[model samples]
Each structure stands twice: as C-alpha cells, then as structure tokens.
Target: MPRARGSGASAAAGGGGAGAGHGGGGRLSGAGPGGQKSARGTALPACLSVSAGCRSSARACREGGGRGLGRAVLPWPPLVASVGAGGGGGTRGWADTESVGKKRCVCLLTGAWLNGVMGRRLGKNKGALNELFSKAAGMLACIIRESAALTRDVLEQHFNDLKGTLKKLLDERLMSLLQEVDAIEQESIKPLDECQKLIEHGVSTADDLLREGESAVHGDVGQQNEKLCIFTKKALHIQLDSLPEVPSLVDVPCLSAQLDDCLLTILKNQIFRHGTVASRPPVQLEEFVEKPGGILVRWCKVDEDFIPQDYRLQYRKGTATHFEDVYIGSETEFVVLHIDPNVDYQFRVCARRDGRQEWSPWSIPQIGSTTLVPHEWTTGLEGYSLSSRRNIALRNDAQSCGVLYSKAPTYFCGQTLTFRIETVGQPDRRDSLGVCVEQQNGCDSLQRDKAVCISTNGAVFVNGKEMTNQLPAVTSGSTVTFDMEVVHLGTSSNEGGNFKLRVTISSNNREVVFDWVLDQCCGSLYFGCSFSYPGWKVLVF
Candidate 1:
C-alpha cells in the first residue's frame, strides 16, 4: 500500500507545486482511486499550505519511509478524503486513505500539465510581440530616412534657383552702373575739350600776328604803315573777351567725392532697395536712314514696372572722342541731323524714371552710316564738252568718249548712292552710266572694254562682258534715275571682304532691279557716266 504514483512526484521534484503551477491556485482536490467522488475538492500541497517547520518534518518522514525505494514522494497536508472501491464499514477507513492519496495525485498532475502548456504559450507570444515591435520600428525608421532625403533635395534645388536668380540680377545692375559711369565721364570732359580748343586757336593767331609784324619792317615806310593797320584791324576782330574760364584740376578731388556720393544715393534708391532686384534695359533701339544726312532712332521699353519718364540719346562720329547728346526728353525716338555722310557713327540711349535722379544704363551701341555725297566729277578727255549747272552736263564726242568719275570713295556697307540722268538727244547703247571699281589711275577714259558698268539700256556689263539682259530703255528727253546700295556679307576673308551691290534704274514708268556680288576691290570705287555718241547730252544730278 505504497503511495500511488502520479505526475505530482515529477512536478514536486522539478520545483513545482499545485499552488505555484496553476497561477497561484492554493487549493487541491481529493477523489477516489477509481475516479470516485471526493469528500473535499482539490487541496494545496503541503509545502505551500503548512508552515516551514511542518513542511520540513513531513519531508523528513517521507524520506525515512521511502529510503529503500529509488523514488521518494513528499507528504501532502492532512485533509479530508473520500472512499475507495473496497467499500464496507470496517474497510471504509482504509479506503478513504487510498482515495485521499489518489485525489492528491490527480490534482498535482493536472496543475503540472496546465503549467507546462501555459509556459510554452507565453514563450511563443513573447517572441511574436518582440518581432512585431521590431518590424514596426524598422518601418518607422525607413519612413523617417526617406522623408529626410526628400526634404534635403527640395531645399537644395530651391537654393540653387535662388542663387541663379541673384546672379542674374547682380549682373544687370552692374551693367547699368557701368553705363552711367561712361556717360558721366564723357560729360565731364566736354568743357575741358572746348577750353583746349580755344587756347590753341588763340596761340595760333598770336604767332601769325608776330610773323606779320616782322615782315612789315622790311617793306616801304608807307606800305609798312598800311600793312600794320591791316594786321591790327584783323587782330581786333578776333574777340577773346568772352572766353570761358579754364577749370582748375585741383577741384577734381571734390568733384569726385560728390560724384561718389551721388552714385551711392542712386544705388540705394534704385538697385539696393529693401525688396527689389535688377531689371533688364529697354528693348532694341532701332535706327532708320533719314534723308539729307540724318538718322532716326527709336526704342521701346519692355519692362512695364519700370516706366521711363524721359529718354536721352547720344551719338558720336567715327573719329570723335566724346558722344554728344542729341535729345533729352520724353520722346522714344529722335532725329539726329547734321551728321556727316558716309562717316561711321555710334549711338546709345538711356532712360530716366519719374522722380528718380539716376538714369538707366545705356542701351547697346548701334553703328550706322549716313548717305554718301558724291565727290566732284573728273574726266580725262579734253574735247568732251561739259556744262556746270546745279547738275553736270556731259556732251558726248565721237572721237573721244567722256568718262566722268568721283574723286573720293565711299564705304561699301550701309551706303546709298542716288543720281538722275536726263538725255537731251538720242543716245546709243554705247552710252552707259554706272559705278565702277578700278585702279585710281586706270579710270582716265571711257573704257567700256576694261570695267564694269550698267548701261542706260539696263544691261549689266561685267569686265566688258554682258552679265544680265534685263534693260530699261531711256528715250530722248527722258530722265533715268539710279539707286545703288552696297551690303556687307560677313567677315570671312573671301565672303566678309566681299560686298553685294543692288542697283535699281527707273525711267518712263519702266524699272529694272538687279544685284551683283563683287570681290574685295580694296580700293576706291567711282560713280560716273560714260558716253560715246556725239551731240547726245546727258545731265547728271
């Protein structure tokens, strides 16, 4: 009647008890050995239910009794019991003992089994929770990294655009400042130039007077007095009383300081204001050829925010050192007259804002030329009859044809030459009028065999060969007008150096137009008329 073997023994040996194993359930059940009902329910193990002394005594007694056996079971706490399978009045007591033992075994085994299952489940859940947290953390970290990268790229691109804009604005402002400085420099030197010219003139005149007085000393006495009086009167006529005072160079420092201050003020007001940047200059400043030695220049503003209140136009000749102001008012265009014909000129323009003292930078300089005025005509023939009126009349001779040519040559680019020829009598095909490019000394006679010419019949002859057959006829008493323009092609040695000549001839409602590409003659070209028929008079205007 040893104690029944059950899972309680294994659980107690592994440091587990009913109360500790079943999540701290302190009760134990007692049932019969054959699974009969128990008098009491599950009961707590002795180790957990009794005091320390009682647990030690019980363990000692169980060890002593079960020494011979290989396994030992600790005693349980005394509790009520149920009956065993052997039922009788006398055997009831023994039956109850067996039942008590069986019930304790069953309770211990159930507690241990439940504890093992719960432990495994808890371990699995712990691992799953840890994995979930790790995954969530990793996802959050990835999102943060991606967001940071995007933010950095966006900020970098924004800064780059801002930098480019700032650079553009700065360049525009610098160009404007440079233009203003150039204008100021030119204006400042004008008075000095005028004063120098006057001084030079006075010196030249004084030297002439001294030389005249010295020469008069050797003449006859009466003649000397008369010559002296004449020289004295000539000197008196040159009035120097109103000469402008020369500016002192010592004042340059003071003037420069004032200029710097003025420029600083303008910069602050126009360019360096709180929230403004630079702006572009006005749009294209165009120039057109005006009749009679003049040019018409015009411009338009593109920036609407910067409306100009006034415009200033300045121009200079090819050999000039300073630009002279041509117009300074609100007009967008101006006519600059008195320009020398066939001379190269450059023009610039600036605009002033309303209530602002500083003028905008000058526009890019435009280069152009005035219309050419033909030089006096020269001829080599002696028997050729000529008449000098407002226009020149050349009477043809049969023995010697007359060839009249200009003395000076004009530029091939941007030049227009116009003239009219009226025939008095019937003219043959041999009588021609056009422009030619030949050696200066080779143009002595009407040599149609050695030069290029456009005939009155509108045929173009190149080097004495007919190049074009389109001819406009000129009848007797009819006037033929010719207009020629020379255009530059480019700057290459073979192409840029060459020029294209456009010719238009009109007479009696008939007109002929043609263009010819000419090689670089590099010398002077002459505009002239040639005639061979006698009694045929041609008047050139």
Candidate 2:
C-alpha cells in the first residue's frame, strides 16, 4: 500500500481528516488528510452509503461507493493502519485493518457502476445530438432553397402582370399624345389655308385694275375714250381686297413624352428596393393547444404594417437544442401530428415577404404537449399474444379471430389508432378490425352490437348492421386506421336526449365515415380488434 504523504496527527486535529486514502472514490486534495471538505473549511470523514436502504453493506464498501451492490465483490483491506489514523493510534477506519481482514460475508462490492452508467449515457446522448443536428440542418437547407425559389417565382409572376398593365398604360398615353399632335396640325393648317385664299383673290383684283388703266392709255383720241370707259366699268365691278395677314409657319405643334427621362432607371431603382424580407419577425407565437394525439401551434402578426407573404413553423423536443422546420405555408395555425403522448415540444414561427431572400426572425418559442396517453397492448387471449407494446401475433391454433385490447381507454377527440398488416395466413372477408365500448379478458366474438368494424372486403358493419359504403378492398399488406369522438352528448343525465358518436376508418385509399346517435351518453371508449384468420400479425401505434 502507498501511504498518504500527509500525517494522521494533522487529521486528528479535528478538521474532518479521516477515511481518506488511495481508492477509486477516496482521493481528495492535499487537505492534511483524506476526507470531504466542508463549506467552513473543515474536512469530515464520510463512509460509503447506499440510497436503496442497505445497512451492513454501507460501511464495508471500500473500493465501491454508492453505485454497486447487485454486481458485488469485496476485497479485504491490507494489514496496515489507515492513512489518517490519529498519530497512527485513532479508531480504525474502513481502510485500515490490524491484520489481513476477511471479506465481509454480509455485503459485496462490485465497483465502478457510476463510470459504466456515465459511459453509456454520454455515448447515447452524443449520438442523439448528432442525429437531431443533422436533421435540423437538412430541414433548414430545404426550407431556404425551396422557399426562396417559390417566392422568386411568385414575385416574377406579379411583376409580369405589372409590366402588362404598364405597357397598356404607356400605349394609351402615347396614343393620346399623337392625337394631340394631329389636332394641332389640323388647327394650324386651316387658318394658313384661309389666308392663302384671301391673298389669291387680292392678286386677281389688282390685275383687273391694272388692265383697265393700260387700256385707257392706248394714246388714240376717239377709240381710247370708248375703251377706257368699258375698262373702267369692268375694273369698278372687280371689288379690291386688302393684303391678307398670314401666320408664321415656324410656329408648329410638337409632342413629347410626359414621364421622366430616366423612366426605366427610376423603375429599376425603386423596384429593386421596393420589397423587403422582415428584419425582425412580425409574427409572434400565440399559443399551443393540446389535442388528442397532436399539438396545435398558432401564431399571429404583431405588426400590422409588416405584411408577410408566408409563415414557417419549426419545433423541437423539449430536451433538444436544435429545432427543425415542421411547416411552411400561409396558414397561421398548424396541427403537428404523430407526436408521442405527454412529451413536451417547443415551437416558433417566422415570416417572409414576396421577393425576399430570407425568412424573418423566429418568434419566441412556446412549449406544448399532447393529451393522449401512450398506447400498448394490455390484453391478449387464446391464440393472440403480444410481442411488444406495439406488436400483436396470432398463432396457428386460433380457430376464430384472435383479439387484443389497448392498455387503457382512449376517448380523446382526434386520437387515432393505426394498425399495419405485416403478414397474413390467407386473405378473407372474415378479418375485421375496429374499436368497441367493452373489453373482454378472454377471446370472444366481436361485440358487433356496440362496435363498428371493417372487413377485408368493402363491407362495413355498424352496430350489427352491414352497410356497403364502397370502401376500398384490402389484401395481405394493407394499413388500417380508425378514430372516434363524441360529437354531441346526451343533453340530460337521465339519457333522454340525443348522443352522437363520430367514427371514421381509413384504409386502402378510401375512408368509411359514420355517426351513431343514441339516447345514452358515453363518457369514454376503448379500442380493440379481432382477426379471424391465423398467422396474421398486426402492429398498432
């Protein structure tokens, strides 16, 4: 044995320096002697204790501390005094023995249980963390790429519509401007043409006057007088007009576009900066409602000014650090399905606008859980046996249908029971699966009078009455799922009013839905199923 370097006299000076030595859990700092240090700077010796109420096994444990008992073995301490024996003369501690001690027959110590537990737990935690991280990363990548692409497409479509409208508007304005130019041309030309007509008439009148004057000056005495008299009469008949006043032709109508010179440039700059991805998310998580087998996560836009084109929801398990995108769409409320019962989940929402590259910041996370209980097979009879909580097996000896029941009643609305047909001895119409209001401890015929079930064929039986709803036919490998909820309970406790039960069964690409109304109210319902054939295996979740 390697003795402790610190002496026992210092430990005996009353500082809780006892029981400290070389072992798996006994090593302490250089505290004069071995022991657990106290808050007041004093050390106290502590013997090994068991939380599961072990009496004799407590003090005898040397190597093992509180962790080992079932896997136990005890080795005798060597014939040396404890390292902290008072001046090597105090009461003997568990570590020291006067001679080679015998193994305590009452208790055994198979040590290192805590180390094993830590090894397993840490290893599993790391693997789970990696898996969740990888899934979250992949989900985020898909949301980013797909959301951005869809938003881009929608934005382009809207822009295309805007461009069409703009083109039509510009065309209308252009036509109007051209028509104004035509009007100006017509108006100005009419006046100029009238002035030209006046000028022509005046020139003709002046010519007639000159002709009379010339005839009168012919220089002949008798003939000149007579000709001048005729010319004078004709000239007097021609009324003279003053010179016409004409407008300058340089004054002409011109047309120009009304918009800015850099119309395209203005549109480019404005449109480029018109839309924005939200900097801070306007949507805030409202509440989480507990449903039968799911949670309804709801959100709302806090800032009415910031209108988002879409919203995306994300969630994570309570113990998880990373959250994965669960939904992305315009609906503000989404029901997350297939969650384990009673397990806590955290959820958040983000927003994105049209033509935006990124989603808005996530809303503050909210925690939620479902109200349904965990499902397990509680009763199996005759040829029916349970392999696990979710699996059921039917043996070859089963003459009639083997039956199984859930561990407890599931009456919560929206809770669904899903079963898969893994194997079948043979396919027949006799095979049925459904839920009932009663549970039997032994194999018995299905109480069809109070239950609803579906067969391998397309027939459905409701309360002992067969109804052909034309549901899809099932074969060896079909999946069946069913759920029931109370629509309206009886109004009076005396069972005098109407009670409604809404039951839905889905399988083989079709669903059979029916509602039963009676005079009595049913507070709860139990789920079970019976199979007539042998070698058929079913698993439920």
Candidate 3:
C-alpha cells in the first residue's frame, strides 16, 4: 500500500509507533473515559471508512441522526452450529439480504411511522384516526406494550444470529493461521537442534586433547636424563600476521547504562592485561582487507559478572548473525566491530549476564555510513511559536526551520533540499529566532557566501542578496505550524563543512550563509531541529 510522509512533530514524539510507515498517524482516539461507548459500538466523532453493504452498521459512525444507530449485536459463543445455516454465502452482501419480500416489509413499517407522526390517516378521516391513536382506549399500550415488543423480538433474533455467525468465521480463520505457523516452526527448528549437538561434541573433543599434559605423548627415559634443547637465533626469521588496530571507544555508540561498568572491566582485562593461553591471546582482534567482493558481519555479547578470559567464544548453530556464538563470559554488555568496512552494514548487540538464559533485548540497530566526512542529523523542529505580532504576519516569518546534519565529514558540494520544521508554544517579545544554515569545515563556518536563511522579518536572502520569496503571516492562538518550503541552493565559491541550524535572536546573526549574517541565538522560540537522512548523495557535483 502507498504510505504518506510523516510530519516533523510525529518523529520527535516517539512514545508511540509514530513512524511515517507504521500504525496510525498519531491522531487522538475517540474513545471516552475507560473506553465507554458514546454510540452504537463506536464512539462518536471517530473516523471510520465505510464499505459497501454496511449502511445499518454505518449509521453508528454519525451523530444526531433519527433512528437509533444500529450496532452489530453478535450472538453467544457455541450458538452458531454451522456456517451453512447462516446463509451459504458470505455475511450481508447486497444480493443475499435485499430480496423483494424484505424490501416490502421495510417500506410498510417506515410508512406507518411517518403517517402516524404526521397526523395522517389511511382514508379520508386522517384527523379522527390520529386522535383515536393519541387518546383512545389504551392508546399508549397499542404502540409501546404491543407493537414495540414485536419489533424488538425480531431485531434481537436477527442480531443474535449474526453475532454467532461472525464468531464462527473468526474462529476458523484463526485456526488456519495457527496451523501454518506450526508447520513453519517444525521445518526451521528441527535441523537447527541437530547441528547444535554436533558443534558441542566437536568442542568437547578439542578441550579433552588440549587438557592432556605432554606426559601423555612423551616416553621419557627418566626425570634426571631428560634434556632441554636450546639453540642460537637462526639466520632465517619467520614472518607472521600483524596485530589489528584498536577501534575507538566512542565508535561503540550508545549502550544500555546498566551494562556500562561491566563492559569496562571486560575491555580492561582483554586489552590491558595481555593475558593468553597456549601461545594464543584470549581475545584477538584481526583486520584484513576483504577481497573486493562478498563480506560477512559479526556480533558478540557477554555476561555481566567477572568471567575467566579462557572462556570459548565460538559461533553456534541457529544463531545466524552472531559471530563467535559463544556468550562472552557473564559480562552484561557487548561490543560490536565492523570486521569489513568496504560494504554498507548494520549490527545488533544483545547480552545476558550470570547464567541467565533469556537474552536481554537487542540494542537498536546501528548503521555504518560509508561517507568519509562526519555529520549529525537532528530530531527535526517542533512546538514553536511566533513571539511578536509583527512576526506572525507571514508564513516564512512565523515559521521555524529544523536542524539537518551531514552524514559525511564535510559537505564539499552545494545542493538544495527542503527542511520540514514543526512548532507549538506561546509567543512573546523576548522569544526571538531565525533559521541558520551554513557549512562547518571544522571549527570555522565555511562557505558563508552560498548559504540560505529565513527570519521573522519575512525576508529570505542568499549570498547577502535578497531572494524573491517572502514569509507569510501567522494567526493568533495557533499552536502547530510548518514552513511551505525552503531550499539551500549552493554556489560555486563555497563548499565542504558541517551544517548546523541554530535558533537565535536576530541581533546575534554571525554565521553568514552565503554572506548573510544570522547574528542571534534565540532559545525561547527553540523547540528542536529535524535531521536529514545523510550527507551522501545530498551534495551533487
């Protein structure tokens, strides 16, 4: 199905599944307190798209209509014995229930009610009949006690029957889905168990051999006669692989705070202690240039408590993505490394400490961007307001621009892209603000000449020259607002640097995008900034 792009406010409000592609678009639900009913099965004011042959049920979607909204009154479970009795065809299609006989019965009932309410009669004495029905002997009993009972009986029976039929249909559907899932589980898991057993056997055998002392292989004459050979250094030297470079600690990304202390201890012992057994280090980090072709990714997790370094770290069956499938000795934290850097990649880290078989939830997936330049994306702009009545006079003037980071280390080429900003708050005189877009080449804000900016004054300028577009006016008491569109069209003179959008007052405009000074850093109007996807493919030659 086609999907709509999400708004900036939606992403920052991350408590719900408000992503652009999943779940509802963050709209408020119409349910009342404790989910009380406001109308027939549905709360009033709820948005529902009606399908064909759903008129009776559809009436509940609206309010203030005459005739009570007909709710889908379902029957008791175990009431519907068979689908065949509930009309062989599917539920309530136009052809199944709209026969000539049914139509006549409905019309007759409708006419009777209209005639009685309008004070009309079947023949010439309309007035007399109306007076008789209104005030004659037992007039109220005729309508309520007698007529209402029959109508209610018929409706109740039909509703009960339909309810039973729907329940049966859903039960059948669920059973089918469960069977399919069961088959899939059997097919995928049976072989995995067999493979795991074989791996365990091999490890056991290797451990036994390594445990045997040299005495098991050696037949010495006597302890005193035993000779130890020592030789001088040989002319020919052996060449071996060089050690892998240590990765930066910051490269690990944000991890669970609970695991921080435990992870530090593991890294200290493995890297700092230089402990090894059998002439091989307990932990080895090796790097090699992959043959410019297919590549592999690996993940490792450890238990929390102190674990012996000799613990085996080998891949196991059924674990498709993790390398060295062995759980790192009881360390509650995990560290991930990009064994191969040429390919685009992502990795997940999960850990469980102290013999806890249930693994902790996997950390958020982290993607490694291939760009040489480093940049950061913002959370997008949100909840902003215009301070003064003058600023509310225009679209560009009343709006807020969000922050976008370059994934690459630098933006070498200039390009134009739209930045979506969101905001809501009270406005005041001191709450000054403006949009700042410029290239950051290290400490200096480079390319001051080719930047673009918009401010409360409703003016847009690039390279110190005024642009054609002007800001729109704002309305009072408006909480949410967005920019129509703004672009950063790069020029030939300036290129390459980090870009940051600083919300500031007009007086402090210092970072000049295309030579237009954005002097202020107004924090009052500040909500936050929105980040772009990345720097790669953004800057074109």
Candidate 4:
C-alpha cells in the first residue's frame, strides 16, 4: 500500500551524494549516505512477502532455488513484475485451504468412534470380572463359616465319646475291685488247720487233772451236808428237774424273749462257774438296755449243752456305757439296740458262752438300717400288700384241678408261661414291686437253689437249660394287685433230679405271698409233678 522503505537498490546506489530529496533527505549526519554515525544501522522494510496466499509464486521460488543460477526465470520474479505494473513489486505466501479442512474432519470422526467402542468393551469386561470376583468371595465366606461350625460339632462329639469311654472304663475297674474284695472275704472265712493242732496239744495233758477234780467235788458235797444236817439239800439238788426243757425255752412267745433268757443264763452261769475255778476266766465289757422306744436288744436263754460258761459278753458302739462282768451260760444270747425310722446303725455283741474256758467270741456284727420311705401309710396298713394264688373258686366250679403249662414249665424252647397273681390293696406303684422264683435242690428247707425271676419290670430267664439268656422288661397296670408272670424257656434236669420252684411276691416282710410248683420232666409229654402255688390261700387276701 505504501512505498517500500529502505529499498535495497536505493541503499546500494547512494554512495556519496544526496539524491533528489525533500528538506531532510540528504545525509542528516552531514557525513554521507553510508554514514556510520546514524543512530540506527539501517531501516528494515515495513512488510515481508511471506508465503501466506500466493501458491504459484511460492512453488516457482522453491523450484528455482534448487536449480543453477540463470536457469528458468522464477515465477517469483514474474509475479513481482505483475505487482510492479501497479507500482508494487513484491510477493506473498499461500495460506492453508480445503485439503487440510477435509483431513481434520476425517480425523475427528475416526477418533470419536474408536474411543466409544473401546470404552464400552472395557466397561463390559470390568463388570463381568467384578461379578465373578464377588461370587467367589461369597463362596469363600460360606466355606469358612461352615468349616468353623464343623469344627465345633467335631469337638462336641469327641468330648461326649471320651466321656462315655471314661465311664465304661470306670465301671469295669469298679467291678474288678468288687471281685477282688469278694475273694479276700472268702479267704478270711476259710477255717485254718492250725486250730486243730492247738487243741491236740492241750488235750494230751488234761486227763488226770479232770478226774481228780470230779472226785473231790463229790466227796466235799456229801460230807458237808452231813455236818450241817442239810439233808433237805437233796430236794434243792432234785429241784433242777422242774427246770423248763430246752425245747420249751425255744418255744417262748417271741424271739426277743428267747434272746433275753439266753442272756440271763450266760450271766448266771458266769458268776457260779467262774467263782469255782478259773480256766481262762470270763470278763464282760459292757451291757445295758435301750431307753424309750427302740428295737432294743435283750439277753435270751440258750440250751445248757450249747452254753459256754467261760464266754463273756461285750457291747460296742452306741450310748451304752462300760462295765466288767463274766457272762456264763450253757448258751449265749445278746441283744442289739432298737431300730427307728430313718436310722441306720452298726453294732457288735460278743459271747464266750462255749466254756472251752477261752473267752467267748463276739457275735456276728448286725446292722439296723431302714430303706427310703417312699409312700405314706394309709389306714392301719404301714406297708403295701401283694399275693398271688390259684383261684380255688375256679377249682370248685369243676374246672381242671390244675393245668400243666408244659413238661418243663420253665423250659427254654423260646416258650412263655404267662400267669397272674391277685393282690389286695392299691400297692405303691412308685416303689420296686415284683415276684421272685427260687429253685431248691434237695434241702431241709425250700431255700437252696432259686432260679430266675420274672419281675414287674419284665422277664428274667434262669436256666440250667441250653439257651440261657435274660429277656425284656414287663409292665403292670393299676389294680389292688395281680399276678403277672412270664416264664420262658425250660430248664435242663437229669431224670429223677429234684428241682422245686418257689415263687415269692413280697411287699416288705409284713405283706407277702409265697408259692411253690414242683415239676419233673421224665421224657414224657406230661410233666410228672405239677403242684399249685403253696400258701396261695394265705397270700391271696
């Protein structure tokens, strides 16, 4: 738009003179056009012909610059000439156009689509990974919790099993101890042969002494009576004939009374015999009577033959005090203290009543202990009552006198004999109630061998039979009472062997029913002997 400042041609030709100029055109420094004294070294052109818009000229400049000088006049110079035709000779560079704009549009579109697709895929993968990881975490937690619970259960089961094992071991140890104790007791009671040897030694030297003593006693009595003129003493001697016989004494009204008589005899005999001679004198330790109400012990008389005058009596334990006296008698009797409800006591009493001149021995130690009173006494009955008997009324009705259960009534062919015993009163259901069967094998009493019992709780199989076993439990209902018997399996017996069965149902000692049935199997279909329960009538009430 304006004239170019500091033209290169103008600057190059103005060597020494000022050219045609305005007032301040000549060298202002007053030196020359090329003055080194000017404030600025040179003035630069106001505008540059940068390659912003002129593409053809820029191409020509770039191409011509790569060639040799004078080769093809550059379009740059031609473009300058065209501008100079309008009084301006300069070139300008080209500016960016449509191609770059189209490139930018494509780049923006491709980058946006790629970023969206990749982001979605990455998001989906992350979500799936998180789900799987969460599930695994939950499963791991459940496993850990279950493992803890299982460990707890295992510990509890282990403790219970250990406890059971310990209990079983303890029970076995206790049974072994009991067996050892029984063996020791048996050994203690066995008689020693040494006692016989001791007796033989003493007896060998006593014949002459015993004979002289008997002779002197008879002469003294006969001579003394003549001097005193006490011929009436013969009646005193003969008065002994009036003494009650031994059997009569045993038949005394009560056991307590008989015991008292024996005690009196021991005391009286000790005074008389020990006063006469001392062959190992008798000395009593202590004796007394129980006061108030009690199951007191009393002295009882014994047979003269069984009495040992050298035996002395002593009492141990209880409120009884001490004393010294010889208890001499033909027989020995000593009493125990009385019994009371809920009381348990153990006491000892001894006698040297057998006058082998050795002090009499102590009696068997006895205990007065009562069981737990589970039921209250109703009416006058202090105990329950039970009894079982064959209905004689049925017998009178012209039925069979007795029916045989089998050849071996208590046999072992897996058979059962069920029978009932009737009882009186409502028995104590809470207490242990039942029946027992005892088998006696040739005894003066029916108390020898008792077989198994079928009790209220259930079946007991006792056998000399081949199949020996215990059975299950039995039950009872409320009735005054009834006989419930289950006899299973038969017993084995040799031909002609005697085996008696005694069945006893007891409610304490006061109320009881006892019966016996005798059976013999002699290879016959019919059992040889079958008897009704004995004493059934007395118990049935």
lDDT (Cα) of model 3: 0.26
Lowest-sum lDDT 10-residue window in model 4: 100-109
Worst 10 residues of 1 by lDDT: 17-26
- Candidate 2 lDDT (Cα, whole model)? 0.52
Q: Which scores higher on TM-score, 1 or 3?
A: 1
**Which segments of candidate 4 are over 4 A away from where they belong?**
1-122, 193-541
**RMSD of every prediction:** 49.8, 23.4, 31.6, 58.9
- Give the per-residue lDDT of model 1 (tens digit) for 1-541: 1111111112122222111111011122211111111223333222211111223322332343221111111122221111111112221111111111112111222233223422233354445434433553454355446546765776678668877997999799879877877777888888888888988888787788878878787789989999888888977887645566887788532233223468668766864443322323443353233323455454555355777888888888875799888888887656565656666677777788889887775654555444434234554445355554223555655464456665444413222233445444555666666666753343433335435565656666655677645556655665554455544465663444556666655555565666656666333456666665655555443
540 Cα displacement, candidate 3 (Å): 18
Residue 90 CA displacement from its true place in model 2, Å: 86
Which candidate ranks first by lDDT, i.e. highest?
2
lDDT score, candidate 2, position 318? 77
Write one digit per residue (lDDT tens) for candidate 4, span 456-516.
2222222311112322222221112212222323454334445343332222111122333
TM-score of each: 0.29, 0.37, 0.17, 0.17
Cand. 4 Cα-lDDT = 0.26
